[model samples]
Target: MTGRAATRRPGLARVGATLARAWRAVSWYVKEVVGENDYEHYVAHLRRHHPEARPVSRREFERAKLDRMASDPGARCC
Candidate 1:
C-alpha cells in the first residue's frame, strides 16, 4: 500500500467503470439502430394494447415481419 499503487488502483477502477458504461451505451444504441429491440417493443405494445392476448414468439414475429418486408422491399432501406 504505497501511495502510487493505491492511486493507480482507484484510477484503473474508474477507467474500467467508464468503459463498462460506454460499452453498454454502445450496445443499446446498436440494438436500437438495428431494430434488435423490436420484439421487446412488440411484446410491450401487445401487453399495453391487448392485455388479453398473448404475444407471439420472437421467431414467429421475425418471420412474419420478414414475410411482410419481402412483399414490399421498397418500404425498407436499400
Candidate 2:
C-alpha cells in the first residue's frame, strides 16, 4: 500500500468508530425516552402540543416516518 493510503486509514477508522458510538448513544436515548409499545403515547403527546396538527392514520404515519428517516438520517420523531 502507498504511504498516503496508510496515513488515511487511521482517520477513516476513527470516523467509523465515532459513528458507531453515536449510533449506540442514540439507541440508548431512544430506549430510555420511548421504550417499545409507546407509539400511541408519543402520537398523543404530539397532538396535545400541536392541537392544530391534523391526525394521520397509523399506516400513513408509519410510512411517512420511514420515508423521513430514509431521506434525513438526522430527523427526529415528532
Candidate 3:
C-alpha cells in the first residue's frame, strides 16, 4: 500500500464508529440488568396513572425500595 491507498482513513473512522456503538449497547445492557432505568419508568408511570402526584427523586426512590425490601422481617436478607 502506498500514496492514496496508505493515506485512506475511512477504515479508522469505521472502527471508531463501531466502538462507539458497541459502548452504547453495552452500557444500555448493564443499566437494564441493574435496574438503573427504574426511576425513569417510575416517573413515566406516575405521569400516566397519577398525574396529580409528584415524582420522587432517585435517592428517595432507592431508599423507599430498600425500606420495602427490609420490611419482610422474617425473610432472608440479600
Candidate 4:
C-alpha cells in the first residue's frame, strides 16, 4: 500500500477504538443514572455471595426500593 493509505488505516483504527470506548462510557453512565443496571448488579451479587438466595424480579425490586425510600424521611429532601 502507499504511504498515505497506510497512515489512513491507522488513523481510522484509532478513531474506531476511541468511538467504541466513548460509547461504552456513555452507555454505562446512562444505565447508572436511570438505575437500569441496578438489578443486573444485584443479581450478580446474589449469585456470587448468596447462591442459595433467590434474586428479586426487577418490578418487585423497584417497588420495594420505592417503598423503602418513601418510608425513610432521611432519604429525601424538604
Q: Which residue ranges in model 4 land beyond 4 Å of their true spot?
A: 1-3
Which residue pairs of candidate 4 clash?
none
Across residues 1-78, which tens digit of lDDT does each residue of candidate 3 receive? 577776677887889999999999999999988878889999999999999999999999999978976887565556
Top-lDDT candidate index: 1
Clashes of each: 0, 0, 0, 0
**What is each predicted model's overall lDDT from 0 to 1?**
0.94, 0.78, 0.88, 0.91
* TM of each candidate vs. truth: 0.86, 0.44, 0.71, 0.75
Q: Give the TM-score comparing model 4 with the true structure, all chains together.
A: 0.75
Extract clashing residue pairs from model 3: none
- Model 2 lDDT tens row, 1-78: 699999999999999999999999988788767643345756788799988877687777777767877989764665
In TM-score terms, which candidate is top? 1
C-alpha positional error of residue 70 in candidate 1 after TM-score superposition, expressed in Å: 0.8
Candidate 3 weakest ten by summed lDDT: 69-78
